[model samples]
Target: MISTLTATHIQKSYSFEGIEQTVLSDINLTFTQGQLYAITGSSGSGKSTLLHLLGGVDTPTAGKILFNAVDINAMRQTERTMLRTKNIGFVFQFHYLIRELSVIENVALNAQISGINSTEAYDKASQLLDHVGLRQEKLKYPHQLSGGQQERVAVVRALINSPTFILADEPTGNLDAHNAQALMDLLLDCHKQWGPGIIIATHDAAISSRMTHVLNIKDGVIL
Candidate 1:
C-alpha cells in the first residue's frame, strides 16, 4: 500500500525573544496504511509541531509534506481545507467537543459538514458512538460525561468522516492509567478495523511502547 503521509527534510522555526529558534531540522518520515506510530519528545521537542505539519494545521518553514504524493505545501488554502476534511482526522489531549452539544451531535457535526445528509450523518454518528462505547452517553453534554467518556466521544467524532489518516496529540494524556489503556485499545481497534494511518504524539513512555513503530524526537530531529 502507498504511504498515507510523508514529510521530507522538514524544518520548522519560530521567533522567541526576538530571535529565531529552530524546533525541527531536516526531519524526514513516512507513514503507511495500517501502521500505528508514536512520536515522543520532551516538552519542547517539537513532537506536536511535526504532528501539526503532517495534519496540515501548520506548514513547515522548509521542505515538503505530501499526502499520497501530492505536495500539501503547494496546495491553496481552500484546497488544503478540502483535503483535510476528506482525508485527515484529528484528536487532541483535550477532547475539544462543543460543550453545548450532546455526544451524538458532536460526532455527527463532521459528517454533516462533509455534505452527508442529516439523517445519514446522525445514523452514522450514532453507530460510531456505539462502537466507541458511548452510545448510552450519546445524550449527555460534554461536562456531564467523565473524562474517559468525553474522550471516547472525541474519537467517535474523529472517525465519523471515515478519514484515511488519524492524527492524535496526547490523546490519552488527561486520563488515568486504566482509562488511558482503554483509550489506546480503542484507537488500535479502530486502526485495525479501518486501516487508516494512525500517528500519535505522546509523552507517556508506556503508551509509546504499544505502537507498531516509534520515533524519538529531540531538538526537532528524529533519533
Candidate 2:
C-alpha cells in the first residue's frame, strides 16, 4: 500500500516566558492508505500536538511532514490550507457544527468548501448522513440534536470529501460508553468501506485496541 503520511524526525515546542518547552521530540512515523492507527497517551503527552502536525494544522519545530510524498511543513500557508482541505479530514472532541445549519447542510459545507457545487454537495451529504443513520435528522439543526447525534454529523462531514486521511483528536472523549462505541463502530465501518487512512488520538483503550496499530506517546516520544 502507498504511504499516505510520513513524519521524519519531527519535533514540536512552545515558548513560554522566554523558555522553550518541547512537546514532541524526534518522532518518526508513517501511515499507509487504508490503515487504522491509534495514538495513545496520558494528558499533556503530546498526542494532540502530533496529530495537529500530521494534519497540517501546525508546523513541526524541526523535521518534516509529508503527505503523498510532498513536504507539508515547507509549503506556503495557503498551499498547506488547500492541501488540507483537499486531502485531509479532521474530527475533534467537539462536534464544532454550526448551530444554525441543518445536519445535512453541515455535512455539505465541507464539500462546498472543496469546490463541489451546492446541489451535488447536498446530494452527497444526504447520502453520507443516511449511511450514518442520520437521514431522519437531515433537516434538524445542530442545537436540536443530542450530543451523540451531533458528533455523528461531524463524522459524516469529515468524510463528505472522501479525503485521503482522516485525523481525529479524542473523537469519543465527550460521549457516553454506548455512544462512543457506536461512533467507533461507524468509523471502523467507514475505514473498511472507503479505505481512507485513519489516525486517531485517543485515551480509550477499547478504541485503540480495535485499530490496526497503536503507538503510545510518553514524555514526548513514541514508545
Candidate 3:
C-alpha cells in the first residue's frame, strides 16, 4: 500500500536559556491513505509537535517528513505552503474561527486561498455545512454558534480544499460527551465517504479505540 505520510529519523528541539530541549527524537512512522490513526500520549509528550511537523506547519531539526514521497522539509517555503494548502487539513483543539466572518465565509476562505472562485467556494462550503448538519447555521457568526457548532465549522473549513490528509490535534478536548461523540461520528463518516488519511492526536480513549491504528508516544519516541 502507498504511504500518505512518512517520518524518518525525525527530531525536533528548541533552545532556551542556552539549553537544548528535545521534543521528539529519532521518530519514524507511516500513515496510509483512507486510514484513521490515533496518536496517544500524556500532556507535553510532543504529540502536537509531531502533528505540526507532519502538516508542514513546522519543520524538524533533523531527518525528513515525506508526503506522497516528497520531502516537505526540503521544499522551499512557498512550495511547502502550497503543498500544505492543497494537500493537508488541520483541526485544532480550539475553533480558531474569525468571529466577524459568517460560518460559510469562514469555510469558504480556505477554498478561496487555494484559488477556487468565490461562487464555487461558497457553494462547496454550503454543501459541506449541510453534510455536517449545519446548513442553517451558515449565515451565523462564530460567536453565535455553540462550541460544538463552531468546531463543526472548523472541520468544514479544513475539508474545503479536499486535502489528502487531515491532521487533528485534540479536536474533541473541549467538547462534552454528546458533542464529542457526534464529532467523532462525523469524522468517521468523512473517512468512509472520502479517502483522506486522518491522523489525530488525542487523549480520549474512546476516540483512540475507534481508530485503525493506535500509536503510543512516550518521551518523544513512538512506543
Best TM-score goes to which candidate? 3
Rank order (by lDDT, best first): 3, 2, 1
- Location of the lowest summed lDDT over 10 successive residues in candidate 3: 186-195
Measured on C-alpha atoms, candidate 2 has an lDDT of 0.87
lDDT of 3 by residue, 137-161 (tens): 9999999998878888887798888
lDDT of 2 by residue, 71-110 (tens): 9978888998777777888886676899888888888988
Angstrom error of the Cα, residue 21, model 3: value is 1.6
Instruction: Pull out the clashing pairs in model 3.
Output: none
Q: Tell me the tens digit of each residue's lDDT in model 1 across 75-190.
A: 99988987777788888667789988988889888888888999999999998777667768889899999887877787778777878898988888777888788778878887
lDDT (Cα atoms) of all candidates against the true structure: 0.85, 0.87, 0.88
Which numbered prediction scores highest in lDDT against the true structure? 3
Please give me the total number of clashing residue pairs in predicted model 3.
0
